[model samples]
Target chain A: MSLGIAIISLLLLAGKQIEEKFTRNVAGIDMVIGAKGSPLQLILSSIYQIDAPTGNISLAEANRLTRSPLVKSVIPLSMGDSYQGYRIVGTNQQYLDHFQAEFSEGKTFEKVMEIVLGAKVAQNLGLKIGDTFASQHGFDGEGHAHDEVKFKVVGILKNTNSVLDQIMTTPLESVWAVHEAGHHEEEEGKGANALKLLEEDDHHHDEAEHHEEEQEITSMLIKFRNPAMGMMMARSINQNSTLQTATPAIEINRLFALMGFGIDALKLIALVIIIVSGLSVFVSLYNSLKERKYEMALMLSMGASRTKLFILLLLEGLIISVIGFVIGIFLSRLGLWLMSENIEQNFHYDFNVLSLLIEEIWLFCGALLIGLLAAAIPSLGIYNINISKTLADE
Target chain B: MIATQNLTFAYSPSKQFTFPDFDCADRETMLILGKSGKGKTTFLHLMALLLKPTGGNIQINHQEISQLSVAQAADFRAKNVGIVYQKPHFVHALSVMDNLLLANYLGGKNQAKDKAQSLAESLGFAEHLSKKTTQLSQGEQQRVSIARALMNNPSVILADEPTSSLDDDNCLKVIDLLTKQTQEIGASLVVVTHDQRLKEVFEKQVLL
Candidate 1:
């Protein structure tokens, strides 16, 4: 019974926390513009950093949208390389200002090949000021190393309790320089014809062409002057523009709707377990009353009222449920703490387990009601005890 | 004082009993003796207000109790009547002292811990007061039962075949304790038993 309660409570806590965290992290950003493909993929890749980018958008198109009257502020992200497994995000100070992230040690990056690390990234990599490391071509640290230009760690950002803590931040020129170096190597290996063939095989071929023309960026996170303008802009961009637009709020809500079904099913199973446990408590009390029929009669003959005896039995049920509730809540917190520890070690994600929620209060009341009903069902037998008959039999 | 007039009870229409009249005044002991099949326990239960007699006028301290409601009768029993059973039964979870205190609690009287201690001392089981009731010997349990019956200083004390399972010597000891404790508390004592050994112990007797 306790295990069932614990599992449900833990799931509820984690689900609420994750939903709130996702919403809070994306609260300011109204929309994302990236290479045209899946809108959800665009939002997930740009805002959440959990998925691959749909494709790259030219820096000229991103700059054009930034200069629009409907747009409030724009933060251009140029991604493609990684240090270890953490993505090295190339953006300006606007990204840090938007996330309210501050420096924990040293200062922000000021030049090409100089980087500032996020709190978790620095801790996990054990990188410090003045330490230089080469970037890998891909996000998971498996591609060719850009050892030609080793970037120096200039500073570490404070823990923002957001996705920013799992990334490294540097100038946009840093990412362009590394990718340009890779492009040069391809150009030198086989003349202009080989370069064109390589570009044909590349998914971001348009991005490279645009980079050659000027510069290219992976995506742009945009905040509209009014949230209602996001719909108008998204429609126009999806219909006429090559770039795709996705609203973070809509995509996140869709994601939650998909996850809600599984969570609700598990919650129902937990509730059923609680009900079965309540029935088990009822059976145990009923059997005990049968065995103590004579003893109950003896008590009655000693002037104990029937109501008093009934309440005594009911109290037994209440005590059992209350104890189970307390232990169940404790177990839930313990389970969450262990989960947070594992996630922190593997994914650098932090979860607040010590925070209490209002839903748990309602859960407690529901549990107590189960206990009362279970106890009351069997305690009703007190009214039927025959003092004369029971005592005479023994 | 306790008295019953025209007391009648029936498990069914065919199985019925009309008990003879009986009265015991303050500090006096009365024995209702009968074989196993006789209605001795039925008569005792009727007097204790645990079973309502189909026809009877039971008076305790000059108040007629037959017409009382279930709740009222329970209150009256708690305040005026005490009972010791054939086989001593105590809540095994409680200490010997708590079992005695339960009488006062049920009777809606003060806990009277000192009174419980005095009763335990007089009954000769004061040393076992802190022990669980199950830890005591059968004879010791009988003594605790008698002490519990006197805890509320009730006006009437009823014993239902209290010595039925005891040997001759232990039976005499139990009967002596019940009678002596009732006298000390100035309560009327009534013992219903199939035990022939108790016939010689009381002068006032009603045989069924």
Candidate 2:
């Protein structure tokens, strides 16, 4: 019975937390533009930093979107490297301001190979300020290493309970420098020149030089001045250009709708289990009342009214239901804590299990009602007991 | 004091009973003897007011009791009468001491722990008061029941085949305790049983 309650409540807590956490992680961003592919993949890779990028788009072309009057601001992301399974996101200071990420120690990245670690990434990897480590080529942490250009951890961001907590942030030129070193066969000095671009700071110093070079970024996250303008821009970008645009709100809602079916099915099974538990409470109390019929009659003849004895029987059921609900809640919390620990180790996600849900209050009341009904049905027998007949028959 | 006159009961048209008149004064003891199928328990139930008499008047302490309502009967019984059954059943979940105090609680009287201890002491089961009733021997359980019946210091004590399940020695010992306790409390005592061994024990006897 407790297991049934535990399973039901745990599923509710987990499903609710997952939906809220995913929605909250999409804060501030309105749309994502990336290489032509599944729009959801673009949103997931760019906004959430969880999936691989579709493919890279030219930096000069992505920069053209910034000149549009409808766009409020843009944050370009350069991906394709990792450090111990945590994604290394290459963007500017605007991205940090967008997330309201604060520094626990040190400061933001200023040099080309300088990086700022998220709180979880720093804690898990035990990387301190000024520590340097070579980035791996892919997201799996098993790809070939870029040993030539080592990135130094310059800062550690405070815990924000967002996707920012599990990533390493660096300047965009650092990605170009690391990959340029990987393509050593093309030209050796290009990697050194990309490293020197950190001092130039003005990425668009020369348009002919920028477009002549095949420099690219994975995606651009954009927020529009108005919802109508965002729709117009998204439609134009998808139809008139080779890049794809995805609305974070729409793609995330579609993802949740797909997941809702499985969650609803589990909830139905949990409901049935709760009902069965109520039935078990009924059966046990019914059988006990049968065995104690003589005792009931004896108390009755000794001046106990039928109503008083009836309440006593109902109290037995009440106590059972109360105890079951309490233990069920405790067990569910324990289960969630264990799940959180496993998820933190692998996915770096934390689940808030301490907060009690309002729905669980209703579940408790339902359990109590079932218990009382089950007990009340059999307790009705107290009125029919004949004192003289029971004593004589025995 | 307890008395019943012209008592009649009918379970159906084919089943009926008429009982002899009887009375026992305060602090006095009476034994009503009969064989099985002779309405021994029915007569006891009539005086206990567990069943309403179809026609008769039962007076306890000179107050007519047979015509009392169901709730009133229960309240009156709780305050004025105590019963000892044949098999010595109890609320098995409680200890011997708690079982004794239950009488006071059900009777709407304050639970007297000191009174329960004293009763246990006199009944020779004081050391076993804290143990579950099921842990005691058959003879010890009967003594506990006797102590329970005296917890409220009622005006009447009814024993329904209380000693039928005991051996000859335990039977005499139980009857001695029952009569002695009733006398000490200044309550009337009545024993209804088919046991022939008790016929020679009581000075005042009636055949049902």
Candidate 2 lDDT by residue in tens digits, B1-208: 9999999999888899999899999999999999888888899888888989999899999999999999999999988998888889998888988888889989999999999999889989999989999999999999999999998999999999989999999999999999999999999999999999999999899997
Regions of model 2 farther than 4 Å from truth: A185-213
**Full-model lDDT for every candidate:** 0.87, 0.89
Model 1 clash pairs are none
Evaluated with DockQ, which candidate comes out highest?
A: 2
- lDDT string, candidate 1, B1-208, tens digits: 9999999999899999999999999999999999977888889989999889899899999999998999898889988998888888888778999999988887888899999899888889999999998899999998899988888889999999889778888998888888888888899999998888888788999998
- Tens-place lDDT per residue, model 1, A1-25, is 6877897899889998888778867
What is candidate 1's DockQ? 0.58
- Model 1 stretches astray by more than 4 angstroms: A1-4, A64-67, A123-126, A134-149, A179-214, A226-232, A239-242, B167-169, B200-204
**TM-score per model over all chains:** 0.88, 0.93
- State each candidate's clash count: 0, 0
Q: Assess the local accuracy of residue B198 in candidate 2 as a C-alpha lDDT between 0 and 100.
A: 95
